[model samples]
Target: MTTAPLISLTWTDHVTGRQGHLVIDRLVRGVSSGGLRMREGCTLDEVTGLARGMTMKEALHYDPRKRYIPLGGAKGGIDCDPRDPQAYGVLVRYLRAMRPYIERFWTTGEDLGLTQDIVDRAVAEAGLVSSVQAVYPLLDDEAAARRRLADAFAVEVDGIGLDELAGGCGVAESVLTALDRAGVSREGTRVAVQGFGTMGGATARFLARAGLKVVAVADVKGTIANPEGLDVEALLAARDAYGTVHRTALRAHDAELPAGAWLSADAEVLVPAAVSYAVDTANQARVTARWIVEAANMPVLPDAEDLLSARGITVLPDVVVNSATNAWWWWTLFGDIGADADEAFAHIRRSMRALVEQVLTRAERDGTSPRVAAHAVVADRLPVIAERLGWYA
Candidate 1:
């Protein structure tokens, strides 16, 4: 196999007046973009890999939308602990120094550790234009600019709801896709979700409302399991601000399992909505669910995916899981309004359903798993973009 050439990479150490890292693994003409990830042990290679994923995602969107706008995938990372107050100034400085690059191709927003306030600070220090301002800078009123930015980022297709619904919708779609492939019905399917953050909580609520028996749910505090199913409303009320459902509060109806027992619970589907790499090689054997829907990015590593596949468990890849909502958000942000909000949502639903069906169909035809089949789909599409750009004859 031939190695891909590195496209753009730079490092800048603004806090110490030294160089820190800025990597652009691939570019798609006028459409290069990605999210900023802040974690304790993030690496340049990991960031670069994520950038490559973005490239595939954006390319997939362009073909379907037929916008012909140049778009590429890119990502940025910082290895600093977000809890440390002192690191805030350094991060701001580092971000400010990268203003020129961010202005040229990247438009960042809240990610894992980053918040809206942090994004605003970075934009101010860097003097980069906001997505709304980039299009309507002449509007003098400050309040108007803020409102426009909010609208630019708001959930237009579904109206202004909690951001958690995006995650829930992705999870719901993944579940439905996997069930369809497995010849299962979603009407009364049982599900157990681990991690009760934005994604997990929303997924639980949505699934419960969709008639899925939410037999088990867990968070940082502990796990709760009830074969007869638990009340999502009561669970939501018991959940704290951080989204952790108190085990003691739910003690009346269910037994408290081990912290990670949600994985082994009796259910047809398992949704990992927490942080990344939760289902690795160590706990792969403990996964008893027939299907695993990754609500979090890269929650299951490559090896774990292989292990589960070998055991006849269908694992839906995260690329398809999160990309639909992301595409919707990005499309709305860029002001590429569809016929209407309903029309926009329908577009997203169709794209997601098609991608899922494509992966499943290819997997069945090739006698391979969906994860492996996804790579081929991505590889085939990338070259078409390259050929269009004259990178391939």
Candidate 2:
């Protein structure tokens, strides 16, 4: 990967407190895009690394069958009290402050510590052009899923909106694809998801509904389990605002398991979508899941991934599992918008499943992990891709 260029911003406010070390990495065609994150423990390097990863995400997500609409990578972070009452106000100020840069050069959506409502309000407060109104700089005439979303962004400012639902669906598709490639049958595949938030919760529900037996789930507070299969929709409904299932709620259905119990659940698929670095070298051995889908970025680090690979665990990279959500190729192929909720999800499901199948097949043929194989394909084309778009000389 080429070295990334960086942009830095800083500010202090009496009402919202202090936030600094704002950064943007990897602008292409004088434009960049990624999610905005606000968290107390976030760091400058973390944000930079994430920004660079977005570039890799766009590049590695390439599919020969799909149009390669030019989109660059970038990420922003605000180190702040996510739970603070004033956080919302702070976010408004931050968005207002970022309007100048974003209006012409960047586009960001919700990520960690953010919500669709928050982004809408912030964009409204900033008096910037609505994302819907701004045409995607990429040149493509085909109707892709993202183009559908771009169109949706125009009309549905008040409706369900994008950010959308594909993250979970893509994850479920990746898990199922992995299971099939590994010769594991879906009917009896036990699954454990460490994170009951939107992504993880939706994934658990999707997988369970798809015939996989979901046996364990966790939130920050703790893990809950019932090998017989926890009631999916009930637990999802019982989750607190922060995705935590109260012990009282869990006791009624699943036995509240010990800390980190989700990692050891006798399952075939494990999705760590809650937080970064959830599975590292320290506990890679305790991980009993044969297949892992990284719904969250960098959930499994390099060293730990190596360990898992040696252990015969097939850990699909986030670039493959989480890649399709924002993949320009997908949006470009989506051809037209105005899709209802079911149509939207259905589109994503087909596209995601196809991508997963391709990646897994390539990994098998190349005799390498999906991460290595995917990156190998992307790295060769990076310079050519950049040069074609007049990004880097």
Candidate 3:
């Protein structure tokens, strides 16, 4: 309920001079959960907003009957390109600098340019027990929880890690739920996604599998588009760790356009699955899609959302769509779910669909945007959570 973060710390990297930031927006039961992202222009303000988003995400999935209790929200970000030679060292150093918080208050994994493997490596290098060790005290069986999460992370479907696919499954499910509500058909429905990293790639894969046409996918190099629907599998296979797609993997019919062409792609759904503040007011006018489902945090700027809403373009907020990955982690760790891929996907689909339907239905009733409706839901739940759990169980 506070406007400011509980704790905000900015550190200047000793070797590269890059700045890194940590924002603990709220803590419930003495712990907060979020992820650390590494990007070229990652700022303290961005991390602050993401931390608050995490708070909302944690609250949005709160279910008292479930074994997984939502932790508070916090986030970490470093202002450096993950591809830089010094990036890994910077990550290790940043982890080392924030070891105290990681050990005591924040439970973090991968976000944006970072991956879970990289985070684990950095955490070990920093001499920490685990990236999520902060919440161990709250677990009923710390060892079992640890093994459960580790096993879940190790399980892969169709050669992609389950951890990587969980968030995208949630995003795709949100889009499908919205379409189903509108009486739209999924078969041949067009989709354009920005960024082809773990989130975007997995989203494209699931949507394509569900009979949607992924016509465009944008990455650092540019956009790959095919009106007849792209080969999502091939492209996904060609991506690097940073999500850049290889040019050679493109088919003869696949057209390479400027990176920003994704906004103009002829599609019904546009998913900004990469960076924060991607769709701004200036470029929001280029969007022709009926829906913009955010798979990345804060992709649609507030001003852009207002304009898009006025134009009758629905924008699904990221807090609800992308909360699955974090929730999946806790659900597995806390025994609500197990280490099986089918069970994880099934749970993600059920929960995300229910959440999307709830938010959209509330928005229709309240005459508000989905973001506002989601915030209202969080507002109602936060107090209940605190009242019942006493803020620090």
Candidate 4:
């Protein structure tokens, strides 16, 4: 990472029992946060890279000139089949092991195979312990800690604002903002969303609500499309725990297509919300969308993004687009104790839209991708932020 990494530590993975890693790229208020991702190819290096993006995301949201919430960037990952029956216990143990760091340094929510339900279970235990320790020394009683823990979970696990949905909301915010900046109306604006999981499904539904046509949505099961737009709510009902919707879900209206069909869909916008590297060299040429808003981490490779930028495609970076929920996490924890899910969503939509617009303005004026422009913004603030946040001290 170009910026000095603050903390790098590994753990015995719950699912695989192999070595996995957690890294704190930066720290705000003596703490950091990000997602806990688990899949077949996950590695420490990948976690580090994701952590770096989290740092950039924090910088984007906590811009000193704007409404900011101080939060450092962090990420964690384990390599295993999270579908295994053993995953729950393993995840719980993982969190228990991370108890001290979580209390004092980092907190991870959900990502990839790690669902919000599982996240609730994993972090709930750690938060309880941390909350207990926080007040036990001074108050010398469990009542205060118990109350604190209850409040944190009330905001975190409540039905209205699941962490993954929050992420998807953020992605939708970026897409809407980018579209408005491009002078594209939401009415009849076709969107092809690849990877119809938590983030993708949420983005599709919100876009549909905003009068955009969700023409296509693809998951691991298959891709379903309708030029007139799919019924997002019905499709959502059919989605499985992992975000896949099979023939049973879209039974009558489904236009069964091959995998990766969303990439080539004739649409004004494309959102890659599932796997990383969806827009690599192999399929970069097939992405016909005028605006590519990366809803997933590292969805577009560097060279591929370069090619698209050269071809006049506006590529919004994942950090900026996916920053909403992270900011919400910090805000709910340290800024506003009474913030509800709707308020959090509205605030993030406003904040992220403004941030995306700023990046787009600078990028368009300077003939650079949104990512490069965003990096310049973060670079200018990093030195000062480092000093203030106790980096390299």
Candidate 5:
């Protein structure tokens, strides 16, 4: 049996008849943290599961020594294709309708199908102070924290924003850590990433820079494969906001395969950084990689993961792999790190490396998957957090 969410509400848009859902899985210090995502078929159950994942993501990062503390998990999702002409209006209406929750309980930013800039613009248009204003009160100095976070977001590294690169840095570190533990050489390691959006693109860039060959990348249109390794930076430059690559940007030797071809690409590591439940029970057999590093939330289904485990393909769970982005946001806002890109990157690498090592060590000791080990880490910390601060602080 699963724990029920603290709050669940479905709001119907009066203008377009579209529906949006918000699920506050838990609240710590009277606030919950998560992101708002927009997709065509987003459901309450999906939002519920994501909200719970947020809880675990938060708890897994809890450290008494760190200045940044983890908040409870919550998530908001809308059921509408972001490309629709009416999508922007639906978003504004959703934000307007959920204003009270935004002001009091939920602290949200961008997730799938939405960008932080879009969310910020819509939030302002909807008369909200900020997308993350709900957690302002918890900060020691709200104004200073806001300024720090603003400055951090303003800083860009190698043509990409620091905010965008943080998560991918963490994801890449997890892969490298796994490879190191297994005695695999990064020089010849091949990686195939699905989705060239924020997380996937960043992961590809970092891994490529780290001496890993990004042999294949899949976007909405199809998979672009190069056995000798694709030019990651060129492909990144050709991507639109939605991450679809321009066909003209491909090299003459690049092979355009079906979008799902990324699943079976000959790579040592596979990254599913786009949609949820991408690697399900049926498609699990196509995976030939030794490591499946999840950069997106809930990309692998439970039964599929069980089968993959049986086959000895280790899955680095998303709860640990993708938690860095969320942590980076809070870390910047709470004064854990400053606005410098190098500082932020260094902090993320160290933290993620340590976290991956811990999760892998525990998994080996207990003969469990990385997901189970992550959950155990969270289980150990949640009570400590609640005991020290009280549930609502």
Candidate 6:
């Protein structure tokens, strides 16, 4: 009853003699690309599923008929911790071993623990296009290698960093998208962000500046609330690297509540930008936000999505919000786009806004949740490519 992976990949480092697992769950229209998540728990199946999401994301974002860019969904995973002393070398060797396969069928990018530096080193050592034509005859030309390296390198330089603000921007964008769908004005919209890390904090600050009152915010340490609004700058300064705001330092400004209390905060929009699977079936009942925007990947469980949808709470899926950063990276790296920081941010904003609007409109028309509507849209796009390739006949 289960389906098979569209593209399977395996790599062994020639230098370190270490083997890495890679998988592409689904190749939309025979083209595939996605982030390379390097972590101990990352599995072939998980990466493959991520790749399947990437396939849908690419299909929804990039139109081959209009843009001339044919992207499928591909993902690579190295089963090692970046903190390991030999991590860099192992990654280099992994890239060299997978160079042929990458050139032939996939493009790689940073994800999870894999940073831009690692990607740059890997691409550089692998020589963009691999010289070993036996593995990729179609990529025999040296120009292909150069192009690949150039593309990968560009993403490294232009891609979003691990800045705290990146997550906030994504959260803010998601909230904005949801409001737009409801035709609700944000002039005095109340918002609460659960997780004070880069994503949550940044979203709070941005939302505050945009006239939305950030009534509540929480971290691993505890939650803070002020029905009027919270001073984002002071709170950010009091927070630690893990996004935990020191409880002792909070006496100057507002009311401090227990950890994870933001879930019950009275707000129009609630953003869960912290850890994965934070909102599951158990806590789904406690959440009281009118709209939930996932600033983190899969913050809500599959079953919870249905629950929230039934309760009339709009849940904007993480697949699109978190992908804006990736889109910016891809455009900057492969499209030869983004000449400056401002331009790069603008590009991200434009892409995110357009995608949010498209998905929202589609969802409204179909009278379905945005996530389901997005899948439907992707389903529709797939057939066009299938027909083009004569697979639908």
> Measured by TM-score, how close is model 1 to the native structure?
0.82
Regions of candidate 1 where Cα sits further than 4 Å from its true position:
1-22, 68-70, 116-118, 131-149, 152-163, 233-251, 254-256, 334-344, 389-393
Model 1 over residues 222-257: C-alpha lDDT tens digits? 788898898876787677644678655674768788
The regions of model 2 sitting more than 4 angstroms off are 6-17, 20-22, 63-68, 131-164, 246-253, 328-338
lDDT of 5 by residue, 1-393 (tens): 178999999999998999999999988998899999999999999999999999999988888888898999999999999999999999999999999999999999999999999999999999999998889998999999999999999998878899999999999999999999999999969999999999999999999999999999999999999999999999999999999999999999999999999999999999999999899999999999999999998999999999999999999999999999999999999999999999999999999999999999999999899999989988888889899877865
Poorest 10 consecutive residues of model 5 by lDDT?
384-393
Model 6 alpha-carbon drift over 4 Å, by segment: 1-3, 8-21, 28-31, 38-40, 64-70, 77-99, 118-171, 194-202, 216-228, 233-251, 254-259, 334-337, 386-393
Selected candidate, larger lDDT, 2 vs 6? 2
Predicted candidate 6 versus true structure: per-residue lDDT over 1-393, tens digit per residue: 025566677666665555577776554334456766666555666666667777676666665533224356667777776667787788777777676667666666666566455576667876763322222332334455446534433442222333224435655776786787678898889988887765677778778878898888887667898887888777877776456787666545578888778887888888887656778877888888898887766678889888888888888887777766555444543443533445555556666788888888888898988888878877887677655643311
* C-alpha RMSD values across all candidates: 4.6, 3.8, 0.9, 3.8, 0.9, 5.6
The CA-based lDDT of model 6 is what? 0.67
Clashes of 2: 11
Tell me the deviation in Å of residue 38 in model 4.
1.2
Model 4, residue 194: distance off in Å is 1.6
**Cα misplacement distance, residue 92 of candidate 6 (Å):** 5.3
Tell me the tens digit of each residue's lDDT in model 4 across 263-312. 99999899999888788977889878898988889989999988887787
**What order do candidates take by lDDT, descending?**
3, 5, 4, 2, 6, 1
Candidate 2 residue 329 C-alpha distance from true site, Å: 11
lDDT of 1 at 198: 59
lDDT of 6 at 392: 13
lDDT of 5 at 206: 96
Clashing pairs in 3: none
Alpha-carbon shift of residue 32 in model 5 (angstroms): 0.7
Q: Which stretches of candidate 5 lie over 4 Å from their true place?
A: none
| TM-score of model number 3 | 0.99
Q: Each model's TM-score, in the order given?
A: 0.82, 0.86, 0.99, 0.88, 0.99, 0.74
Instruction: Write the number of the candidate with greater TM-score, choosing between 2 and 3.
Output: 3
